[model samples]
Target: MHKEKQQNIKALFPPRPEEPQESDCCGSGCSPCVFDIYHLQLLEWKKQCSDILCNAGCYSKTSDGETNEPLLSPIKFSPFQLLSVQQHTHNTFLYLFQAVRANSEPDQESAVTEYTYVKRPLGISVGQHLVMRCSSDGNQNTVVTRAYTPISDLRASNVGQFEVLIKLYENGKMSKYIQNMKKNDIVEWRGPCGNFTYMPNSCRHLLMFCAGTGIAPMYPIAKSVTENDLDDTFVHLLFACRCFEDILLRNEMQQLSLYWNFSAEIFLSQVESTAESQTRYGECVKKGRIDKGVVIERLAGKTLQQVSILICGTKSFNKDMINYVKHVGVPDDNIHLF
Candidate 1:
C-alpha cells in the first residue's frame, strides 16, 4: 500500500523544465527569450509541486510556517533597486543596482516596510549574462524583457552592487521603460546565464571580434585574463564601430591596451582616415571595416593551435567574422559566437 501511494504521488508531480542552452539564444534580444520561457515553466512547476505536496499530506511549508523561496534564483525574478545611472553616450548608459532583501520587516514607527540591502556578489561567471524584465503597461500582462551582460567586476570586494551598460534604441520597448526609470525604482532581474567558460591560460592567445554593444560579455573575460598574474593569455581585441565617437568603453579599452599581453585596434567604418585623427588615436585606429585583409593581418603571427576566437555582433557581422576566420583555417571548434 505504501509503495502504491508513493508511485501515485510521484505520478502527480509535474516534470521540471529543461534549461535552454547558450546556443539556443541568437543574441538578437528577441521577445520571450528562451530563458524567459524556462522561467515561466519553472514557476508553473513550483506551483504544481506545492499543490501536490499539500494533497499528499506532506510538509509544504518551512519551519516558520512560511513558504520557502531562494534569495536569488536564475529561474525567477528578484527585485533590485537602481542606485545610479550614468550616461555614456547619446544612446548608451551605465546603470548600477543593488539587490533588495526579500525578508525585510516593517518599521515600528509606521506601516511602511523598510528595505534592506544584501551585500554579496551576484554570483555571475566571467562571461555570463542576465535577463532584465520590465512591464510596458501598468498591467502585468504587457511585459518586455531583455538580456544584458554586466561589465562590473564580480569579485567579492565589490559585493551587493552590479553594473550594466545599456544601449537605448529609439523604438525599443525595453529602452523606453528603462529611460523613464529613476533612482530607487525597483527592477526585476534574473540570471548569471550563459555558457562561456574561461580558465587561466586555457589558450595562448584570444582573438575577440566584437561590434557595438557586443563588447559587454567580451570585456569581463578579457579583464579577468589581464588582471590575473598567472594568466599568460594574450588578448587581441578588434572592435568595430561607426566612428570614434561611437566607440563604447573607449577609455576602458585604452586602459586595457596598456597591459603587456593585451592589444586593441579600432575599425572606423564611417570616419575618413586623416593625419590628425590617426595621430590622436595612434596606429591602432584603422579607417575601414574589418574585412578579409584585416582578419588575415591579425592572424598572421598566431598559429591555429595557440589561438581561440570569440565573436559577437549582429547576425551578419557574426556570420562574416566566422567566414573570415574559417577561410584562414581556424576550425569551428576554436570559435565561440556570443
Candidate 2:
C-alpha cells in the first residue's frame, strides 16, 4: 500500500478525547450519555473506514475468494463558500456552494481585481463524494468533518454551483452546525472520491440499490446515463425508505423517468395509513423492499456480464443485497459496494 493509503487506514478514526466515566455521572438523568453519543459516532466512523478500504481494494477478493493487492491514490481538497441553503424535506436540506479559487496574482494589487476572483468549477464525476470540514466557533479547536455526495447535476447548465442533500440527525454535530450556517460561510472541502466511475456505454444496464441518503450519490449516475444521448445505456434504481415523506429527490427522479430507457422502483417499508392499494404513489413505486423477485424480473433477459450492480446502505443492507445478487450468479467484479 502507498504511504498515504497506509496513513489513511491507520488514521481512520482519530483518538477520542477522554471523557468523564459513567460512574461520575450526576444523579440527574440524561437522555443520552456522552459515552453513548460517542459510541454512535464511532460506529459511523468505523463504517466509513471499511467503505474507504473496500473502495481502495484493501479488502477486495478475487473470483477464487483470495485477497488481492490494494490500489492506492490520494485526492485533493479545496475551499468553497456557501451560496444558498434550501429545505428538501422535513429533515433534509439542500446546500449550494460556489467554489473559491486560489489566488494566482504576483502582487496584492492585482489580486484585488474582479477577474482574479474567478470561481473554479468543482471537478467531480458522476458518482463521487466530497469531504466537508466545519468547526464550531465556541470550540474552534474541535473540528467535525463528514463525507457527503452531491445530488445535483454539475454538468448541466449550472456551472458555478454544486448541490448536496444532507439529512440532519437530532444529535448530529455536523448537521446542526450546517443548519445554522449563514450565507457566505466558507466550508473547506475536498473530493471526487469513490471507486465507481460511470463511463458512457460501460455496461448495458446500471442497477442501483440504495436507501435513505444513499440516493445522493446514485442521483448523478442515473442523471448522466439518461441524459447522455451518445450512449444508449439503461438505468435502474431500486430505492427504499420508511415513508414517502422521507424520499429525497422525488421531482428529480420523475424527470429522469421521462427518458426512454430509465426505470425506477420506489419501495416503502411503512406505507401511509391513508394510502390505498389502488392509490398511485407516483411512477414505479411498490409497497416493500427490493427483493430477489424484483431483481430477477427487471434483469430477466440480460447477461450477468452486461449488468452492473451498485449498492449503498447500512452494513447489513449492503451485505444482504450483495449475497442475494451473488447467489443469482452476478460476478464479484460486476458488483460495487459504496
TM-score of every prediction relative to native: 0.75, 0.70
Backbone steric clashes in candidate 1, count: 0
Model 2, residue pairs in steric clash: 77-190
lDDT of 2 at 189: 79
> What does the lDDT read for residue 259 in candidate 2?
89
Tens digits of per-residue lDDT for model 2 on 1-338? 44565565546644533435657666477768665565566445545644554454323334543223321112555567687888999999998877655555645665552222223334455577778878887566878879888777644212435788999999998988888988777777776678666654556888999999989889888887776565578888999887878887898888888889788888888875425653344576678877777777767788776688999888877888897888788867678888
Q: Report the C-alpha lDDT of model 1 over 15-127, residue by residue, as the tens digit.
A: 76776877999889988888677767755775676466334532223343333332356899988889999999878999998877655667778867566676644656666
Residue 21 lDDT, candidate 1, scale 0-100:
79
TM-score of 2: 0.70
**Which candidate should be chosen as best, given TM-score against the real structure?**
1
Lowest lDDT sum, 10 consecutive residues, model 1, at: 57-66
Per-model CA lDDT versus the true structure: 0.77, 0.70
Candidate 1 is scored at a TM of 0.75
